[model samples]
Target: MKVVIIFNHPYEGSYCNAILKSTLLGLQIANHQVDVIHLDKENFNPVMRSEDLRAFINKNPIDEKVIEFGDRLKDAEHLIFIFPIWWELMPALMKGFIDKVIFPGVAYDYVNASNTKMKPLWDKVKGITVITTMNTPSILYNWIFGNAIQKALLRGTFWKLGYKNRKWISLNRVKMVSPEKRKKWLTNIESNFSKLK
Candidate 1:
């Protein structure tokens, strides 16, 4: 499967980086073609201007980088989101990346679609996986936010676009964990990638 990994962490030495590296290496070992997209490196902007808001009805993504990213999404069979949780959602950059890129017409179509009102844009992709890290405890997030990030990204975005067999693989409580536990968490995600292959 062609897998695209979208990441947004800014620090190279972060535990988030470790998880991403492990995920890629594992996918390589599994012989899956992989592409790594660091949204921060791409200097992705999340904030929308008045023009964008005004053109909301068209939902056309005009940014060049977002266009490139959209092309990759169109071509890939699997998508893996790798990032850290901030306030129970993705970082601002990640959110912006999605905003500027996954436009309504580009990611989905409303005109001449199966639903007439709804169109699935990513039926081309067969699967999705979200590898996320959180500082809060697992139970707290699920209970409070009701897994808000997962439900919003996985069910709201990918599932709406026709992705299947999705997995929200989370490594929780990193801010309070020891180095050894962090390493173990990374290794577990690597193992997951190995299984994906």
Candidate 2:
């Protein structure tokens, strides 16, 4: 299986980076072909300019990076997203990736004349996994923020795209957790992904 990880987070020593490393190790153990799209390292342009909008209207992408990412996604079987939840939402670059890369033609297309229904174009992608770290507790984030990531990223985007196997693994209150607890979480992540189907 080809597993593509869309990773974001600027800090190298951050817990998000650690989770990414653990995920890579697990995927390697499972002998999955892994690709990491490091948004911050690539310095991906999140802003959709005038040309981008025009290309979008025509179902075309002008940016070479977006084109390349779309090409890679064509063969992906499992998609993973790794990042830190800031302000109870994903980072701007991650949001931009969705805005640009997951375009109408690239990710989905209308299923009817009214354009009210959408069908996913990703024939090979079977599942999506989102791994996130945050300072807020999971319960509070859900209760206060209304689990925006779930509603927006998973349910709003991928579910609407026709992918059913969507999963979210959130490690909350990272700053309050001890180093040992964090290590345990990493171990669990590695173990679970190693056995991922």
Candidate 3:
């Protein structure tokens, strides 16, 4: 299977990187072909320009490497997102990736004036997994903010894009976790990554 990991972190020592490494190693050990799209290293701009918006609305397109990568996302059999949840939301760079790359006519299609068809891309991508870190506890965040970010990615985007099997691994209260626990979490991530199709 071809697995794509979308690594969305600026630094190398963060939990996001740990997750990426563990997951990639696991996939390789399981004999799966793995590829990575490192957001920060790719120098992807998260900002949406006024001109870009006009191009989008007019059916023209932006000429960024990230957008091209988004086109690549359609070819995966399994998709993974490795990032951090900051302030109960997705990181700014990941958010930008979604905003700038996952555009109309790519992830999905809504065409015609009267005749309408909702077509989903990534139909072959049967699995999606989110490996995320959060400083707040799940209980506290759920009570205060709920799972908006998870829902947006899983139920909203992945489901709409026709990904059937999805899993979300959120390491909550990451700032308070011990090193041993973090290591254990990474181990478990390796196990889970091996199970994805």
- The true-structure Cα RMSD of candidate 3 reads 2.0
Tens-digit lDDT track for model 2 on 1-197? 99999999999999999999999999999999999999998868998999999998787889888888988888999999999999999999999999999887887788998888888777799889999999999889999889999999999998888899999999999999999999999999999899987
Tens-place lDDT digits, model 3, residues 67-138: 578677778888888898877888788888777666665566665464254456566677788888888888
TM-scores for every candidate against the unseen true structure: 0.88, 0.97, 0.90
TM-score of candidate 1 on Cα atoms, chains taken together: 0.88
Q: Which one wins by TM-score: 1 or 3?
A: 3
Best by TM-score: 2
Give one digit per residue, the lDDT tens place, for model 1 in 85-151. 9888899988887776677756777755454455657666777888888889999999977888877
Sliding window of 10 residues with minimal summed lDDT for model 1: 111-120
Output the number of the lDDT-best candidate.
2
lDDT for each candidate structure: 0.79, 0.92, 0.78
Which residues of candidate 1, in runs, are more than 4 Å off? Answer: 54-56, 111-117
Please state the error at residue 4 of candidate 3 in Å. Answer: 0.9
Q: Comparing 1 and 2 by TM-score, which wins?
A: 2
